[model samples]
Target: MNIPNRKTGFFLVITGASFWGVGGTVAQKLFQEYAIDVNWLVTTRLLIAGLLLLTIQFFKKDRSQVLGVWKNWKVAMQLVIFGIFGMLAVQYTYMASINHGNAAVATLLQYLAPAMLIVYLLLRKQTMLTRLDVVTVSLALLGCFFLLTNGSLSQLSVPAPAIVWGILSAVALAFYTLYALPLLKQYDSLVIVGWAMVIGGFALSFIHQPWQVDITNLTVEASLYILFVIVFGTMIAFWFYIESLQSLSPKETSLLGSLEPLAAVLTTVFWLREPFGTIQWIGTACIIGMILILALNKSSSSKTSKSNKKPLRVS
Candidate 1:
């Protein structure tokens, strides 16, 4: 098979990231209108997304490859983790954040995953903390504090539980990124994602008890919104993300992928007319700045290390 066009893949990555960002806004609308429980929304999203992608896999690729991976016990166990902790945890925590807080705030808090990853890496001794890392983390945390406080620290009126949920969501997202890296090395991207979604969906389904909900009574708009979550937000976006992983290094992919939260914030502001206070905007900018600094610092350090390793000609 021919390699995908890099430019095309990059474009798809950005598009997918943007869709992910905007997903909260879309979900928020459904939540308000249909009164859909967050758990049911998440379960339905994963099931529908999993089935749809499975169909695509059957048509576009060899089914045996996917089935073969599923049959592997070790890989299946990994998929279980991917589903439960990675997909399910991230989705549930994020939805909980949205339920407890507004979409914009929840979305911004979730973007703290990058900073969390840096901390996690440092803790694991996988990476060392440089001055730049410290400053970047500090900036990201300050931005988060601003968002939490809505810029007026004096008010400090944010709910404690909501803040905890937001932090949990960030942790889940960071773990998802870390866990996915190793799995991608060992499995076909789509197959790994498909099985993970299936497992995660079923797990969440049992937890959510979707059968208890009145599925037939859902209005057309609500039903369509759920379908949109399954189709555009989950299946298509995840497929593009996995495809991008095939082409880009993890750091490059993640750095470019920070566009998701920006997209979400913009979508909320423009489409929902969600109020964005000046303080909120400043916080958002700081968050983006921190991410940029981390990405650039990583890139520069990588380049310097490579240059230092070059062979010296004594002639």
Candidate 2:
């Protein structure tokens, strides 16, 4: 198999992020029309995503990789945790945030994943802190603060439960990026995502009990929207995310993924007619700037380290 070029992988990452951003608006619309519960939405989305990926794997590749993953019980257990903590938790928490608060607020809070990733990596002793890292973290936090407060700190008050869920979602997003790094080395990206989604869907189904809901009343638009959530949002986005991790470090991928909220804000404003105040724009700019600084810092450090590996020419 031919390895993908870095540029190709980067393009895939951006495209995946764009789809996720657009997915937010679509979900919001569906929520407004269907009033669907978050739990049901998550369950349906993951189940469909799992089934779709399984179908793809069936036609293109053999079942050997899938069976191999199942044979390793420890790895399989880790994937279950990955599904629960990384996939289902994030989705459920974000939806809970939206239910308790507004879409803008929920999304802004979720964007804290980048800073959370830095803290997690530092705690795990996987990476060291740099001055630029400090600056970037500060900027991202400040950006979220501004966005959440809508430029006024006095008015920045969310429900306690909503805040808890939002923070959890951020943590889950960070965990997903971190866990995906090691898993990508062992299993095919699609295979890993398929199993994770299956596990997550089953878990969410038990909690949601979609069978109790009135499936007969589901409209065509609602069904289509749910399909989009599964196919484009969960499956394809994750595939590209894992692929990008193959070439980029966890921090780099998280930083690049910061574009997701920006894209979400744009899609919301343009398509859904969601209001985007000037303060939101400023906050978005700050977040983008912070991500740029982090990426540049990583790039420069890589170049410097490579240059330092010179052999002495003492003849």
Each prediction's TM-score versus the true structure: 0.85, 0.81
lDDT of 2 by residue, 1-315 (tens): 135666666776687777777666677777766887777877877777777776666676666787688788888888889888877777788877766654555676776776777766667776787776687788888777766666876776456566677778778776676666556567766777777777888998877787788878888988888777767866777667656665655555655666666777787677777666677678777777775675546442222222211100000
Candidate 2 residue pairs in clash (backbone atoms < 3 Å): none
lDDT of 1 by residue, 112-155 (tens): 87677777777778777778778778888889877767777577
Over 4 Å off, model 1: 1-7, 157-159, 244-253, 296-315
Q: After TM-score superposition, what is the CA distance of residue 300 in candidate 2 from its true location, in Å?
A: 9.1
Model 1 CA lDDT for position 153: 53
Q: Quick one: best TM-score, which candidate?
A: 1
Model 2 ranges off by over 4 Å: 1-11, 102-104, 123-126, 157-162, 240-258, 296-315
lDDT of 2 at 96: 77
Deviation from native of the Cα of residue 264 in model 2, angstroms: 0.8
